[model samples]
Target chain A: MDVYLPVAEMAVSPWLMIGLGFFVGAMSGVFGVGGGFLMTPLLMLLGIPAPTAVVAGANVAAAAATTSVLGHFERRGVDLRMGLVVSIGGVVGVSVGALLFAAMKAVGADEGLVRVAYVGLLGFVGFSITREAWQALARTRRGEEPAGGRVRNDLAHRLPWKVRFPRSRLYISVIPPLAIGFCVGVLSAIMGVGGGFLLIPLLIYVLHLPPSLVVGTSTFQVLVMASTTTFLQGSANGGLDLFLSGLLIGGAVVGAQIGIVIGRRMKGEQIRMVFGLLVLLVALRLAADLVLEPALMFSASPPGAGL
Target chain B: MTGLFRIILAVLACALAWVGAPARAQNRGRSAAGIDEAVLVTSSFNGARVTIFGTAPTSPSDLDVVVLVRGPDRPAWIGERQRFFGLWLGQKRLRFDAAPTYFGVASAKPLGQVAAPDTLALYGLTPESQLAVQAGDTGMEPEERDRLMREYARLRAREGLYVADAAGVQRLPGGLFRADLQMPDTTAPGLYTAKVMVFRNGRQLDSTLMTLVVSKIGLERVLYRFARNSPALHALLGVALALGAGFVASRVLRRVSVT
Candidate 1:
């Protein structure tokens, strides 16, 4: 059946929306990312206005994260203290990022520059993660102990204001997690993403979080950020489409459960390899959009179309 | 013979007055025109087919009927993508102060054949005439601005917004004529104007102006209004809905798996 989205002011197939939600939500569940980077562009391609698409994507991310994070909590996988500290920094960073976004928009050079930076950053990160996962997998295949272990001599241990996280079995300074969360928050605002991809990698490499705790903690952070973004977009920009978001969330809730089951079956390296490939795919697609000529050259917009 | 001649003269005088009075009154009064439907926008609204029916006093052969429908006006912009170092960068845009969100024209004959181009423009019968470019010193060349404006109209036409159909109007037996204009799914909801004009020999003789209201109704109406009036409350409602759905789904799925 076709459902009319009141805020977006369009009619779309409910089934199609649900299918889209399922696909993106499953990926979010497996990777512990909010999947905004994927959902926003896909919604826009389906002819939803950019602002409305962003709002809907964020809403789905928030809801999907909730389902997955709860499952993680039941398993005792999440580090609540660390997640809270990171989220505190994220909230402040998002506000600062919004201001920076406004300034960049005024200058009108933000899109091209930001896109180039995104492609470069994603490409480097994806390559390194994939390579590392491959070596780890090969070592297991050769019957050798896996190489990854908690690094004790990193700068994270030397920083002040150290606090112990009993859940993750670590005593580390709050500065690193806060700083990482702040950076992710800034990127989320500027790039219109959930910042889960960046956060997961930083948690593993910088803070050396245990493999079991990585997904849960990252998902916890995503839940907080996505909720903040959804609320801000709805109240301040007035872009949220409830009818659309409801359909997406319905599919996402189910998809997230399936994802959790599938994630449990796979080894950590397998998950990392799959996630790296996904990020790489997105980077390539974005690069192609910039380098290739668009099919439609002329663009038009009515008043109050975007935030 | 004189009595018969006087009666014939009286009949001829009456016929002349009947024919001449309409010609004189035509300039002052508009011919009758109406739309078949009130155009209510419901949840299943894909698009609407508006049938305009009217009667023309003049002979069908000599008269051409033109129907134009325009939706509400809003500010708009057309942008041409600029390139920098082989990469598509920002856009050089032309802002229009007020442009119709929807514009459709239907006529018995092609618009160009019915009247001179300038005349069509003079009466605001063309899309070019309806778009009012914001007048300012934007440092853009006149030719470039004109090109972008035409492109904008073309793009809207492609989207089924600005439509011009030559054979849309049909003449029936007697003086009855009808025209059908299709409103696409993307047609914005607002006050709309539908004009029916009578033209002869490239000159407009009479025209009637009518208004139509396209608005959301039922659940669609309630939601649209609620979002606009109380956005904060609406946001809270949306968040709660999402969170509740997630919580319920997880719990249910877990129980099902256990069984």
Candidate 2:
């Protein structure tokens, strides 16, 4: 059924919106990311305005994270101390990122430059994670004992303000997690994403967080960041549509629950491999857009548009 | 007997004029026109046909009826993509200070056949003529502005917001005529003005102006107003709704799965 979106001022099928939310929410639950990297573009393809699509994507991600985090808590997989520390840095980082984004726009930075940068970054991250995950998977399949020891004398350990996180069994400095969160936040604000994809890798490889606690902790951070973004985009830009958000959240919450169940069944390495593939796919899609000839050369919009 | 016949014919014409007078004003000239209904935008609104029915004093063969409907104006820009480093990048936009959100016109015959280009341009009959460019913008030549204006009109036409049909108006016996202009679903809700012009042999003899309101009502109106007026409150509500729904769904789903 079609319903008119108040803020977007367009008519769209409710079922289509809900279905999109469901798919993205499932990805969020399984991967512990907000999935705005996929949702925003899909909404735009459906003819919703860019700002409205971004806000609605954030709104749905927040709901999906909330639903999955509860499941994670029940499973005793969440590291509350770590989640809180990262979220504090995330909030500050997002604010700084928004300011930086405005400054870049003022300088008339070419949009093509940003896209090229994104393609390069995603390609590097996706390739490294996939290769690492595959090697680990192959070693296990060959009946070889997995490498269990991690180097403890890294820069993360050498930082100041060391804090004991009994949940993850780490006596590491809070600075690394905060800094990692800060970077994720900056990227999320600039790209209109939840930053879960980047956060997962940082928690897994950089912080050496326990695999059991990774998904839950990442989800908690995503919930915080997504909620902040939702509020900021809605209030600052006036693009949040309650009716559209309601439809998306309605589907996302249920989908997230199912995703949590699915995540519980999969091994951590397998999940990482799947996430790596997804990231690489997104990177490829973006690269193709940059390389291909665009169908439409002329565009129309109100002045001062944003991604 | 001939003189008496002429008097009778004059009396009939005056009666027809009185009968066809518009609701807002009495017909002082040879033509009168009014829209059948004011467009009301609702949830189920797709596109609507704005039907204008009227009478012309002369015979249908001698007169052509042209109708132009223009919606509220807003600021907009059209741009062509700029290429850099062998890649298509940002747009170089030209601004239209006040452009009609919806502009459509219909006539019994082709517009060029009905009136000269100067006359059509003078009345702001085309989208190109109506689009007002912002003055005092540097580095943009007049030729570039004209190209962008044409591009803007073409884009809007593709989106069904700008429409022109030469034979959209249908003429009936005894100087009666009706024109139906299709307003797409994308039409912005605001006050719209419909102008009905009567032309004879490339000259406009009479014109009538009528206004109709396109507005949202009920839930649509309430929500649109709430979003615009209280964005902070709306944002809070959106977040709260998502959080609450998420929490409730998790709890309910857990119970269902366990059982």
Candidate 3:
């Protein structure tokens, strides 16, 4: 049986939708990341109208991240202070990005250009993650630490506005995390993703946060950022369809739980390698979409045929 | 003189009898398929058209057709009343805002009243009627069948053009009609039916129906399948799969080291 989603203005099989949610949720739990990067594209492929897909992905990400964050808190894995600082910067960045999006639309910029840009961005991010993971994997095979030598704790020392993060046990300037957060937020807004895949790497390599705190804190930030995006996209675009979100979130939460259990068994190097490869694959797919002709390129509005 | 007059009368009677016999045969063709066989086709739109075609009988009579559209899918109704109003505010519109699911056409005039039924209904070459071909015991040639199909498709395309009911029915220059079909954005995706009715001399004769299917694919349908169904690819990149394998490999290596 098909259920009509009023907000999205489409009829969908509810059971199938819930099952997809479960799969994405599982990936999120296992990867220690929000699965928006995976979910959004998949939704688009399934023919959910683009706007609804973007907003609904954000909402589902927010919900799953919320559940994951609670688990992280229990493990004392989150750096609450750091998360808050980053979130503040993220909110500002998102506002800027959203304003830019509006400006571009007003100027009548071609939609194809926006899509090309998105594909390019994802491609770049995916390749970089894949490269890093491959390198890490090679080093582990030789029983050696990754060649990055120790992170430059020196860079943190020199920065102004230094703050103490007692939980991570590092006295680092707030500049790095805040800047990363802001940049990720802008990218998230422009691309309609949670930016967790981007954040995990930045936290590990740039901010030099401990691996345990890295995943937890980034997940926390993703939750907050995604929630903000959900609300903003919903109110602004009228794109948030609760019925669709509910089905996806319901599945995602269960999948995430299973993913986390699976993730616990993997070594750090293996996890990094797998995550990197996933990014690269996603990037390649996006690149192909941009460079190649789509099978059906015609634009169509939601069923009922009105734009 | 008397003999000549009788012979002329006899010839006139024979001529009249021959004409009368054919006329009765033609009338029988019209009566066999009573005038009440109307057909209807509908869709989830304010205005949609249904077309009906049959062989032209040996004789032509007035063709009456009426179009009635209704909502709610029960199929057993005939001759529902519909009002036609003049264009309102300079725009033609259906009385109701929503698209009606059932529409029909009925007319009482003899087919000859408008034009030769075949000439009026068939814009291009009218192929030998299927009945004629069958009665001749000669099946349609492959080329003929293909040509018929193409013609049918073209006719269908032409018939599909419609404006929303709000636009009312606009008559084209050549006895053709068009109406705007107002399909609401929130209209649910499903099969909708359209019905068409034909009449002769103010009496219903034949009826028929067809269906329109509306379908949609939403986000969840796209994303989940990619992740779950493509397990080979997923296994290649899945962090969990890597993690599980790594765990097992590490355990094996530890045992080897100890041994």
Q: What does fnat come to for each candidate?
A: 0.59, 0.59, 0.05
Docking class of 3: incorrect
Candidate 3 segments whose C-alpha is farther than 4 A from its true place: A149-155, A305-307, B1-259
Shift in Å, residue B214, candidate 2: 1.2
> Best lDDT goes to which candidate?
1
lDDT of 2 at A253: 91
For residues B156-195, write the lDDT of model 2, one tens digit per residue.
Answer: 8887789998878887776667777777666788788888
> Which ten contiguous residues of candidate 2 chain B have the minimum total lDDT?
B7-16
Per-model lDDT: 0.81, 0.81, 0.54
Global lDDT for candidate 3?
Answer: 0.54
Residue A96: error of model 3 in Å?
1.0
Assign candidate 2 its CAPRI class: acceptable
User: Which rank order by DockQ, best down to worst?
Assistant: 2, 1, 3
Segments in model 1 whose C-alpha atoms lie over 4 Å from true places: A302-307, B1-26, B32-37, B136-139
lDDT tens readout by residue for model 1, B1-259: 0111121101100000011113456657644434423566566666667766667665536777888888889888998877888877667788888899889999988999999998899878889888888886246797887788899999888877899989988887866677777776567888888887877777877787777777888888898888888988888887888788889999999999999
iRMS of each prediction in angstroms? 14.1, 11.7, 23.9
Cα lDDT tens digits, model 1, A1-307, are 4665767766677788899999888988888988888899999888888788888888999999999999999998899998999999898888888889889988987877778878988888787888888888999999999786767777989999999999888999999999999999998888888889888889888888889999999999999999888887788878888889998999999999999988989999999999999889989888887779977888888322422
TM-score of each: 0.93, 0.91, 0.59
Q: What is the interface RMSD of candidate 3, in Å?
A: 23.9
